[model samples]
Target: MTNLRFREDGSFRVLQMADIQDGPNVLPDTIRLIREAIRKADPDLVVFTGDQIRGYDPAYIDTFLRRRGEEPGARVRAVTEVEAKLRGIKRRARNRVNNRLLAMKSDGSNPDVQQTASTASTTSTLVYSTTSDPQDVPTTLDELMDETRDKVRRTFAGFLGPVIEAEVPFAATYGNHDFQCGILADEQDGIYREFPGCLNPVDSLEPGTFALPIEASDGSGRVAMSVMMVNSGDYAGKPEENDAQYPAYVVNPRGLDLADSDGYGTPSPEAIDWLGAVQSELGERNGDGKPVPAIAFQHIPPQEFYDCLKEVPAWTPNAVEGARTHAGHCYVLNHEICRPGSRLGEAIGCADENVGEVDALREAGGYFALFCGHDHKNAFVGHAHGIDLGYAPTCGFECYGPKSRYRGIRLFEFHESNPAGYVTRMLTWGDLVGRYSSNEVRVWFEDHCVTGAISMRNELRRPQVFAVLSGAMSLGFMAVIRSLVKKR
Candidate 1:
């Protein structure tokens, strides 16, 4: 068994932020709230789950191009002119030969023929240039990448400052939105593949399961917290090669493709194998005699619970077009063979036989916590096998419609004494906190209080008594109603 130990004390704080897409006015407000939260929480580590910015919109692409002075229209026009000149030369050569042949056959007496021939040649050349050759469209993916990186850097700097400056060590999992190739091919090729800085620093560290030693409050104890960041996308033969099945597996309702060519999301099989090795190396050791608690962070949630239980429209005839039904969960099968299916389960590659990579981790036997942020909705703590899956809220903006509410983050604190377990709390911000109070300052404080209470209850379990009391009250009310109905 690998021994789990913290370099400092056992207690450490973690902040989970998700889905902060960029907008002019919305960005600043979101950033302010994030900065305030960081200051107030003073978390030891911050984890951004995914979707850092909305980079898919064509308008965003246009705006970025305009900013760089590489507008497509001008480039296209210039290329058009060049092509026209080349075509004009070829047309004039053909016309000269044709006129010579006509003159050779007609006698030298037709002066009108010369004028008509010249006019015909000019019109033909102009028509050929205009209709046959088109100008090349100009799009500098490299420039776009540079702009994106600068924007990301500025945004991150404003929120996180320099890592060294903040003196806070952090780790991140590449979300579906973070990896460019999966979202935009040109953007991925230029920014992510060619440019070194475009890739998130954390991505280069280690692909699989790893342990981070965090200090306890007294600084006398340390806790080795296991973190597994896996690629939920499809897999091809090798991690380096893009999977071919990526375009088929769709996770986002907004029609975002989260898979590479192999259909894996981010970490890839190379990363998955690396993670497996890390877990194997860690074994079962917990710092000081407790079991090591492992947390898996990813942009998307496991398909089994989130994807399977949720309601979706049915397209089949007689299925009640808009009726809701229980669908099996989705999972990644062999990365090489994912195909589109008739059902959602088949669509996500979660066939009946697929156990999923995450399941493999849970089966390996250590206290495991799965934290995700793609769903943008609150899920009651759910347990599958032995793993506890917790879905966190998005920090970027509010999720409107259905269960509409304000945006928030999840705060996780792990203690050294209990290495196998950790406390979790939800921190709401912006309009979410506003729903509770009209005063902005009061709302902030109140939101903090609510979060603090949840955290305390998670750790001590003392406040659960209130939950039990509430349940009992509801039960009593139901019993009285039943008795009164019987008497009547």
Candidate 2:
């Protein structure tokens, strides 16, 4: 474990990275963004907010093994132990896709729908090859499973390499997709702990729940402030069961239907109680019997995000849709309460159920800010009730983000004398690398495959692309309205 302390200058800087969400073959642009952010921030500690790996890849046999009630560790390494089960899962998934295509084809009246169905049917098995050399391809189910496990390890190393090389201590919290590929959160936690600079706790109220203490600058061993890290679990429940609680508003960046995605989860009650306990313990130990100041970090935002949002018309510029109880309406940061420099480009994908994190923190009395990262397109800080709720936009290029220029990291600086008066800023991609990169490439992973594309040099400048798209959409809408008026 790495001990966190204020620098000799009485200052500490933290770099937050969220949703790198890449696979074995990580994108070049993603690496560029991360390296540049690390260099520019020169943070004392790095925090990964989750979704480090794409867990939905078909090659992940561990997910299937776990679903079948089988252990996936080295003890169960025989191919025969899982070959039948893996084949069954694959067959069922393929059948479901083919059945849907058949149903669409049966309705020959809609030629457009039929055409789409046919195309999907033909490309159903076109998985992007993760291996560069044909000889590296696995020839057996056992080999495939081994390759998949290796891929997950490689993915972690690819992203964490920079922090490890920089000798900066780092901690992490898991996101919804992190465990989907077969490695459970606790298992992934083990992998994270193997690194040299990891600060993950060996014991906590829950896995991935721990605290980092910043020691006093005056050579006092007393804690000056505490950075609380909590896990915002995988999913509340299946989509069908919680549809009313978390309405799917927009398809995710990976193009997965929102309706099919599992709902986001919130911190467990024990985790909430753990925060209170930390507050009490710290107060007695160092704060002269007063609660120590703290700033919390989690993977998912609390429901209070809606409380700080003001609804607006769908057509309102820069407005994003609301989720869960506030679905069907568009919202922007309520400037009356939110600080300046806040931006919301997409809906808040909060948990289906309200776990009362905000209320708990408000009542606890010392937490000044809460920052999260599940929603990739939002980067804002809002003051609601008594605490500050904020999001650090995703720094990875593999997922849906605000344009290329806006994708970046968030940095927070704290002073030993006054921890509660800490300051933070967003170091965007445009700040480090130019808004447009000659090397900026389209990077994304699908449920079944991973593919990458590079745009022609300077062909798709971020601003011009969006401007043209907006103008074209407006003209098309106007033409449709005119035709309807003439018919009437």
Candidate 3:
């Protein structure tokens, strides 16, 4: 792996990964590949953008517990409700799969039912089965915590072994999926207590920001590269409730909410403070002196600024109609969060509103870039404020649907020799084990391969190159089987 640097002549490398949900059969090979990728890249820093784990299903646990206790009334009722929802989700998912299969078959695309069956079997054999017994559900939160901790530890150990063993510097941002599915706590007590160093070092600065400084090498010599990690999950909270919109959308169908807090996921005041402190500290030494490049990492994109146009009735007789006629574009928009003209507004606090930490960083003034991964698909959205934003690709075996094509990490090269600019390249995993498959029986009973078809919709914005071979072999095997079948 090649370590990077940041200087006019310096170069630096950063490894970015998204949505590596470690569980069952997915962990081992995934971990191995990730390790290999890290080792191969030898980046100055490793950035895991988000969705490290699939969150816990409270209803599933409730069902098992209820069954074990023979509490057929209240417990059973709650379990039944949750189970029904799960069943519904599963039904919908399966229906979608069936529809896709039929469509593929109709298109003469070889439904590859046998291949799908084999893939399904492999997947089933890999995941840990929680449906062993209802009696296993723990009644206490402590027990739940312990179980989650163990799972996280094991998963982390598998994923981090290479990095740890290689002694690579690493940083991470929490994703809504991770937040919703991983361990939750009213306070920071459990995280600190259980996984002492699991949280980013900058986690103390604010509820959502983390930072790490690195030394990059260049032709001129070694230079410093700093990384800022931010939290961008949407949620509703107390401060937000005081506004006229008291009953805000607090529940994130996708984030961990221990306190059941209301409000879109925004950085906490404490987090903002921490970011300010770091930026201020960095500025004091690095600013007004020379050019220093910094990078930001987060799970979500930042909001775009816009000014609403005010119309005068005297200027336009039909002001209301005129207002409707004119395209109102100048309005603060968070494309990832709020819809245009929607009352929900941007979930991340308004940009004009002083988020002390972020403002402080902005005030410090440095060439900063924010790299993120959440929208699964990769694209670059430029910030009007001169910040360059890059979205990284997923490392998961599967892409979004069967037509979306994007999977890679962004490699950044910064140098003092070229202090004013940096270069980015996308590294894809298309060639590495391009096709994955298992036996026919395995696909039918275990992996359900048909449902795991890869999508090829979005093209990554950055210059990307696939190092791994497309799993054409596995896909071809499926194609062959589909071809042999006669349509009804």
Candidate 4:
């Protein structure tokens, strides 16, 4: 329902940050990296594409503790630190219980915790008191589920607290893990709606799907670009619902309770239907008879993404170019045009299959490029039948990826004059971390510098080059040996 306007000069910058799972706790490093990217880009719009928090992922703790190396002691000590905190709490509890016990000792009088007591007799009573008064929220199984509603709010607040504080115009789509915390996408949308600039909240009776308009003054009033936001449903659903969209399920040959596909979500049939309805209601793109040039954002990548990858030109290591051109034709879509320029990182595909969703969206033709998140490793751009399939790189320190990995966000610069001809760049974590650590006057260089020098040495020395040096050194050594023999 909300349409963001472009600058009078027809420019809009969007920051696409994906999988910043800095949850259970706020990660200062992750925040620092993101803060730097935001400050550097100073984008007009921010889009967070799911997995903001690692809801109930206990394995993440072990992953974090061992991100650096195989040091068991270091890992154990890290865990012990938590244990130490728990022990401190236990000590407090032990003291509380002991103080009460001691105060009721038959040989003594009431022992005050503060040691400021002079009681009469040994017949003392032990009484327990609460530090916090009990109120509405209690802790039963059902209550815990209910508390998940509130817990998710806190989790999101911590993960996105900085963005909320910055008051940036932003929107979000859900990934499987987003609902792992017990808060549904719709409920979270309500909290986002309360914020200053949250567009396309799917928090309704329907999935949070909205077409945001981006208009610039033609010296008059006219909207130019329309950005569509869609929500891919969650991984956890009823068995019947799960079976309806996917080919395989738990009851298949594997007798498992939860299949791997169970953890994947996609834009539901209803969502695709809704997108079509919205396109019709929104009418022709700026009344040009053609649908307005638009960009769509979602969290889960559809199966069509796998088909798109076949055409992408191979890339070299390190440089990892953000853009690629492909002859777009793998899946059936409403439009069939070559897509150019992509930036790729760790490539991962949808956990579930896309049952005609791509064709359905293609039928609508409301969007030219689609952006997604779910797979944290993949950060590539591919073209499938005229639609730009963009995958934002994993942007969280706490997520499953390399520690020294180039985790960063994707930047999209939409020119009002060329809405479809937007340029994108992968803003690496190194780029932002560089800005942060740039001020240090330390003499030490990057860890790679040592390896770089070694590589250079190897490159500079050929077999012939080594042979010449070896020959000269051997002759000199022979001369030294002769001279020593003669002296002896």
Candidate 5:
């Protein structure tokens, strides 16, 4: 019932994908890069914006109880070097679950499992065991959240089973390692609404929000865009105080940091006042009386993404040499101007009294932009005055990026008569790894990407017909580069 409006020539395409962090297992090169980002962005919508399920490294139960609370042969050699790295990760998780149940018994696709007796992976039936005294470890955090909640429900069903076997359409948002492994963003959103185009399973919204409706059809009155999801959940919360005024608040004297041992989540102030009451309910009785062009998906980053690094000029001198210096560790005020790796960002990471939820999404007028993915080598886009701030490009080959850029997936081509216009592109996994692929991720999408300009939706939207089609494509690309430089 929510195909999300669109018809007046409504051409919709959205796909973001972020910080994947699939855990306990989901690597077949991250399911061939989520089946090549759903086979080159064949999307009508698919946004993730959060570390999709990586919960369960409660810091080896807080560094094995703060290194076995010291003393006594240095706590039995630090619990025997954390019980020999948990028996070498339960013997390489039982030889990777017996080589994926002997490759599903040589691809007979599990006809009643018999990979030489000892069933385990055909996806994963959670076997990979240990602790029957091979020196044991996990001394509670409820035995490391019941041993990583069955490999985060078999790596979140092997990372949402290739976007529900390519039935695509999808939805997601609670990053900070999706509730840090032990699985519970309402049980990974009830296994993401049993799949098939799950356009938000609505758990009564607002505890991480959701809102689709991008109008162009469905009783099309107009209103052509509004995507929003945002959960941005990180560690704890309860932050308040910092009458915000142009970057100046720092009080995390090591307090209730919700979750860390790698489990990021932060976007509080009740997730920025439920994203300003759903961006002021996208006007016109939520249909199309006008003013409806929005985009927001979260996993942390707000505080005006540090006032959009002093207004983007190719990330403003790397945000002024990244402001100052790292204080608590990662809460950005500095350090991240082209961010390389190691989860950087000192802290403008939304939550501490989130500036009246970005002043009610700048007095809510179909917001503008604010996509996110918790700094995985930041993808840049800044801008604040008329609102827009971005980041999305961390496709999880485990995390930590940058290599001539392209962790891929972040495309958008909206247009249906510009309900606030749209256009964006970035679809790399090095364009599906292997062999030199073409369209090199739209030549690296992000020339301050915020696309959409087919004469801003027809009618030759005047400007002297865009200066006579930009002087006839600048004299037909200078007579085809001067006839190939006069035949060389």
Candidate 6:
């Protein structure tokens, strides 16, 4: 294992990157972003907060196809064909719905139109729900596992190539989606261990929780600061599991639940207890028997985020929608408590359960700040319950994020003399690569359009995209009727 220590100049810099959630066919631009960030930051250590790979993407098939040396254009054409087929199905369904609606306007009592409406709704669901079927995957069970491993390996190597080449020691924790491809979190951890500069511990405090101490720069061999990584789990299986009293959506909007049932899960209670143990262990190691100041990184935000935000009118400026009981309302940083640079572009998708984690961290006595990344667009720091809770924006372009200018990485710089006092800021995509853009139009298109639509192919976004298309069709249909009336 590589040791983490302060530089001889008494400074340490850590780059916190989150949600590189892409499959084996990770986008080239995403790779460019990671490489550019690494080259610019030249961080002493890198921590991937989670969602290293988009586990649900047909990674195995993509890997299988590539290994066969298939032409890239042919592969793109194949996927495009499948999408076209789905789109055709949607078009036919929409036409039927529109025809029925037009007939109903002429004869409101028509039972046939009512039946057709029901059929159209069902067809829409079926078409939108289409996905890579488990039974249709081309490989046997063992072969499937092998392919997944290969996909994960290739994905990691592609994104982390800079870190590996630079020989910067790194560590990672799993996010909800990382294990969806069938490899368990521990297995994924093992894969991470295979790479050079990985600081994942074999003797983990918990399966995905570990600690690394930063040694002082004066060659004193004393622990100067501690960094903790915890794996906040994928989903809360049952309401009782994560202290949740109810499901993610108590009232299903439009009879369609677009949200994950449990939403993103939280670190287990055992993980919270383990935090105290880690602090104690660090104190013992320090030889002073005093708690060492520390910063923690995890994939999901804790419940305390709610305490840090203030609910406001839905139309409130810069307000974002809330989740669970706070749903339908909007929120912004409670400026009374939040630092000036903090921002919230989306709701805090915290788990339903509040496990008193921030309070526990306070009792443990050394934690100064906690950072998480599951809510990709939010990058903020707020003081709540005496500890600072912050978010590191998603660094990967494979998923939804703020526009290119705001989508970026978080940085933390620490000095050995004042390890507890540190400077933190976000290094945006524009900040890193704007100088390289050839022209304003190119930069504007990339920032506003291309970056926003980069995840159009994501399964989660497909339904929303379909809804927008259906609405456009409705508007077009109305326009035709208005033109006919005007001609008459």
Best by TM-score: 2
In terms of TM-score, which candidate is stronger, 1 or 4?
4
Residues 1-488, candidate 2, lDDT per residue (tens digit)? 66678889989999888888876767777777888888998999998887787665444533332111122221112232344355452311122233234323332334355556657645545222323554543232333445566778888888888888888889988887676555667767877888789888878667678888877777677888888888987665543453352222222223232333445677888998888888888888885877777888888888888877898776555565666566667777798987788887666888778888888887787799999998887888888878888898877776656667778889999998888788888888789988764434442211113211212111222355457877999999999999999999
Query: Each candidate's TM vs. the true structure?
Result: 0.52, 0.74, 0.55, 0.62, 0.29, 0.73
Each prediction's RMSD over C-alphas, in Å, is 18.3, 12.0, 17.1, 14.7, 23.9, 13.8
State the lDDT of candidate 6 residue by residue for 105-208, as single tens digits. 42234556667776766553211123355444222234445666888888888888888988899999988767655566777788888899999988886656
Poorest lDDT segment (10 consecutive residues) of candidate 5: 66-75
Give per-residue CA lDDT, model 1, range 298-416, as digits (tens): 76555454332333333221121110122232122221221121111112212122336565565454546766665443323455556666666556542211111255667777776
Off by over 4 Å in 6: 60-138, 238-260, 435-488
Question: What is the Å distance of residue 100 in model 2 from its true position?
Answer: 27
What is candidate 5's lDDT per residue for 1-488, written digit by digit as tens? Answer: 45665544667888888877755666566667677777877776678777666443322222111111111111112323454476454321123344334434332356535543544433333233444656543232333445555556676577667777776667777765465333446655766665566776555365456777666665744455778887765643222221231122112211212211122235556656766565556564654444467777777775567654433222221221221122222122223342232122222344443445556676766677777876655666655657767777677665434432356667777776764457676667666675322333432332122212321322132345456878999999999999999999
lDDT of 3 by residue, 1-488 (tens): 12234533456666777666444224444565576676667666777776655333332232121111121111222323454466552111112233223334423455466675555434422112234454443233333334555655565565666667776666556665453322432122234323322436522454336666554453332336566777765444442233332123122212222123332354566665555566566555555454345677777544432212232332221121111113232122234432222211111212222344345456656546666665553333344455554566556542231111124456665554453376666555433333432222322222112211111111111112111124556688888888888452
For every model shown, the clashing-pair count is: 23, 0, 69, 13, 25, 0
Q: Point out where model 1 deviates above 4 Å.
A: 1-9, 23-26, 57-139, 161-166, 180-211, 215-223, 234-253, 256-267, 283-291, 306-355, 398-405, 430-433, 436-488
Between candidates 3 and 5, the one scoring higher on TM-score is 3
Ranking by lDDT: 6, 2, 4, 5, 3, 1
Better of 2 and 5 by TM-score: 2
Q: Which run of 10 residues does model 6 get worst, by summed lDDT? A: 65-74
Which 10 consecutive residues of model 4 have the lowest summed lDDT? 65-74
Which of 1 and 3 is the better model by lDDT?
3
Measure candidate 3: CA RMSD: 17.1
For model 4 the TM-score comes to: 0.62
Q: Which stretches of candidate 3 lie over 4 Å from their true place?
A: 1-9, 24-29, 56-138, 185-199, 216-223, 238-263, 273-276, 285-291, 305-361, 381-383, 398-405, 431-488
Cα TM-score of candidate 2: 0.74
lDDT of 2 at 294: 85
Q: Roughly what TM-score does model 6 have, to 2 decimal places?
A: 0.73
**Error in Å for residue 340 of model 6:** 3.1
